[model samples]
Target: MPHLTCTEACGPDELQRLLRPRSDVVVEEPDHSTPEDAPPDAPAPEAAFRAVDGPFHHYRRTVHVLERHDEECLVRQRISYRLSVPVWGWFITPLANRELRRPRHDGTQPFWAPAERLDPRAGQVLGVLCLLSVVAGYLGTLLSQTITFAFDEFDAGLATQGNTLAAVRVGVLIALALVVLADRRGRR
Candidate 1:
């Protein structure tokens, strides 16, 4: 996403020039001005509002004037949100992000640039690496968690299992050493 999205021209004042206030949220209060202590050049929020109620109660909307050239001031609006509800947040967060990232009400175009497709060869390599990582992770998890069960089947003692686990840890360190060597070699 772009560092900041621009808004339409100012309504009447500096704060009004930021992102159009969200219709979905009930602002805690209309804090329409920057704090007095803020430096004049600082991109301090021209407007800041927190949602007073609902699942999006944690939403904090801030608008900053990045560049001001008479009537054509560049405004950047940021909406930080997280649902307070426990189970509902998992579902709502993604949906909210998708909705918020694009122009919701206004006819204006989305400021976010769409992602370009990866090269076919790069995509194939990524897929193979992802699959390999999953397999490796599963093998590691299974080995650590089920070592006792495996030893029980072999009729081995606790001391043997401890020694075996210690050996496996040392093997992992050896593998890590090889990875370090490979990384240094690849750089050349």
Candidate 2:
């Protein structure tokens, strides 16, 4: 998964006004516990919202107003979700599960880049390549296990092929890393 964050400045009143127009977002009950590691003087989250219905619901986006002091406020955004299919949810969900966060930041004016800016076509292509690499790696492992089970001995030929597959997997992963790095750099 890729990590992304950006900051914006806005007044607390303005932030609430902005959220008021979003029909899909519903305010959540406030959490009472303060983080142990947080400063003793740190303000508690003033409000929260859940995306119960919208395009964002697929991503399970949650918004938290972490603090509001004077005219400044901080907002925290989190998204975590897995695509589910009826009965065997656990088995299939892992493949598409995603968890990401945009941590709270205090500001006086709102600023946000389009989410699409963080996920361009190049990133999607890299993700597909990564998924293919995983499948290929799994198949290679299965093949090696089957050969060993049948022969009662490790097959050096199959081992060689597995090593080649491993190399290819590493190469694909490296390419994916480079693509993500380039994308991040381009955004900056």
Query: Who wins the lDDT comparison?
Result: 1
Per residue, candidate 2 scores C-alpha lDDT tens digits across 71-169 of 887766443433222333344333222222222232211132223322223334544665777887898678656755654455457676567668867
Q: Scored by CA lDDT, what does every candidate get?
A: 0.56, 0.45
lDDT of 1: 0.56
For 1-188, candidate 1 gives per-residue lDDT tens digits of 11224454443464452344543322234456554545799765767765553344345667777667755666677666654434334544565566554433432323331132223233345446666778888998898899889999999999998898899899889999998999899889
lDDT of 1 at 37: 47
In candidate 2, stretches whose alpha carbon ends up further than 4 angstroms from where it belongs are: 1-117, 149-188
Q: Estimate each model's TM-score.
A: 0.37, 0.27
